[model samples]
Target: MSNEMIKCTNVSFKYIKDSEGDKKEKYAVKDVNLEVKNGEFLVILGHNGSGKSTMAKHMNALVIPTEGTVVVDGLDTKEPKNVWDIRSKAGMVFQNPDNQLVATIVEEDVAFGPENLGVEPSQIRVRVDESLEKVGMSKYKRHAPHLLSGGQKQRVAIAGILAIQPECIIFDEPTAMLDPIGRKEVLKTIKELNKKHGITIILITHYMDEAAQADRIIVMDGGSVKMEGTPKEIFPRVEHMKKIGLDVPQVTELAYELKKAGIDINEKILNVDEMVNELCQLK
Candidate 1:
């Protein structure tokens, strides 16, 4: 069996021109080809208007490609018959948690997905419990979603998708609205989902720190993938990243500067601990 969970082949998307005088078509994404392995944690980094979110939306058929194909779990997203199946297998979590939650109560919100799929009520109950537990939101099952913190509400939103038993989840700036604490919580939860639950994670973010935690990183620029590699490999190309209007992790940037100044520190330093250890060795 193929290990690939999501595949985009020469995909491109163009929004229709508005009836009010705009004539030229604008492509949000352009001939982007990518593949996501099952259970892998993949991070996508790009500046605003780089089409990262637009690329993510194609994973679950939320936006069909204007050219080529998006195949999720071997189902082509462009096929009308495959739309629901593809969506069920590849769930999406957007920027705002508030926009995703539909029920007043947390568990009910989680149950909504499975219920729509015609899952039995008893099965829905099991799924709701399991999904909430996976996201560490089990204790808030009966709590009103509005009363929860941003992170907690996002967990509820994730649980709602988990209830549908998706093989992969596309997170489009899931932590963009979050505080540092909330960001940590959501990031940890998603990592656990990818590591323990064996779910593929495709995270779109502007956070360099978050990208550093991924198994692989894809850097997008001008609606196409400009670079793709492991964090250690990607972060070291500091100048190249900057040229595309993106930054590396803070420590990595510091290490890069030090390297330029004739210091023997590694340019691949991704975190404070690594930087500290490298500097200590230099001493």
Candidate 2:
């Protein structure tokens, strides 16, 4: 089996103008190359219009590249025959939970994906139950989706994808519309999926704290990759991140300022506990 799950080679996408007078071509993603290993947790950070979402769409064959190729699990996305296989391996969860939910009932919503895949009815039942349990929503199997909270609804949405048995999942700002508690729930579920189930996670978010949990971070700007590194390496370049219209975790920024003030604290402090421990060491 190959360790590489996804490979984007010199990918680029440009939107064509519909009107004759509009001669402008806007490239959403430009000559980008990226590789994702199996079971890796990768986060993408960028402001609005940074091409992060555009790149994500390519992972599942939702948006074919205009200039290059996207291969998922060794299946080229551009090939019509490979489309279903690529999508089965790479499921996408978008920002709005409401939009993703198709059925009124939770269990039905979770089963929708598998049912569409032509799974056996018995297998679909098992998968629906298992997927809901994985997201901690098994108890709500009979509950109405609209009655659930935002976090719960999102979990149901995730379960829907889980039922499809995808190897990799792309979350495009899944927590953007959530509250802090909701965000925490979704993030916890995502981490658990990656750690326990060995699912590859491609999380795209504006939240610095969320990106902090990723094994690697890729920063995008103006339809191009601006920076790529581990959280420790990427967050410490606070000035550059700020210049690119992104923020680091609060603790990292504080550590950076303290370093600027000649303190012996580490500039790569990612969380409060690390900051406290570094301060205690200095004292």
Candidate 3:
């Protein structure tokens, strides 16, 4: 049995288009070899068009590798027979809440995926309720999805994924369109899902603070892994990260500057609370 839930071995993908009757191939993802472990909170960071979304689509057979392989739960995504099983095992939550929601009522939308899977009506009902409760959306079960705030709508979309009983959840910048409160709400819910439910969480986002909370971070540039490490390990390499046009967590960047200015402070501080504690230690 494979210990990894997702594996991409020497995978590569290119987009081909006809320009003025001439064929052209542009490589979007190249030789990407990465693994996502079971029950791990892994965050992937990349600039626009860096191939993070393309890599995510392969996890569920949305797109097959042009070269190597993507295996989910030891099942090869390249094999046609495994598509349904692979998708059900690893669910994807996209950035746009509006695009993901399918029904007017919140609970109805949550039930849509499981219903399509031929789950029994009774089981679907229970799963829907459980999922909504998990995301703290049960109070608005019958509420119109459009009437809810951006955060609430995204949580409902997440509940839809949860109702399907997925082992791993891939969040593709789920909080990008949200306001600060909405972002906080979604992040807190996702953190609970990882810690309490032990579900594997794969977060793909550009927000440095969001990436800071992960157990491990994968930084991508030109569709390849530039850095992979714990947040403490990754943020300290300020020059390398800056060269890639990625920012560290706010406090970490401040500390990095302080260290640069001969303040004799640690460069790995991630949050204001951590900085406060460290400042007291120095006194």
lDDT per residue as tens, model 3, 1-283: 6679888999999889789999999777899999999889999998888888888888878999999999899899988999999889999999999999989899899999999999999999999999999999999998999999999999999999999999999999999999999999999999999999989999999999989999999998898888999999998888899899888888998898888888888788888899998888884
Off by over 4 Å in 1: 18-20
Assess candidate 1 and give its lDDT.
0.94
Worst 10 residues of 3 by lDDT: 1-10
| Angstrom error at residue 56, model 2 | 0.5
Per-residue lDDT, model 3, residue 233, is: 95
Deviation in Å, model 1, residue 264 alpha carbon:
0.7
How far residue 22's Cα lies from its native spot in candidate 3, in Å, is 3.1
Candidate 3 clashing pairs, residues 3+ apart or interchain: none
Residue 83 accuracy (lDDT) in model 2: 93
Best by lDDT: 2
Model 2 over residues 1-283: C-alpha lDDT tens digits?
8999999999999997667787778899999999999999999999999999999999999999999999999999989999999888999999999999999899999999999999999999999999999999999999999999999999999999999999999999999999999999999999999999999999999999999999999999999898999999999999999999999999999999988998888888999989888988996
Candidate 3 Cα errors over 4 Å, as ranges: none
lDDT of each: 0.94, 0.95, 0.92
Decoy 2 TM-score against native: 0.98
Better of 1 and 3 by lDDT: 1
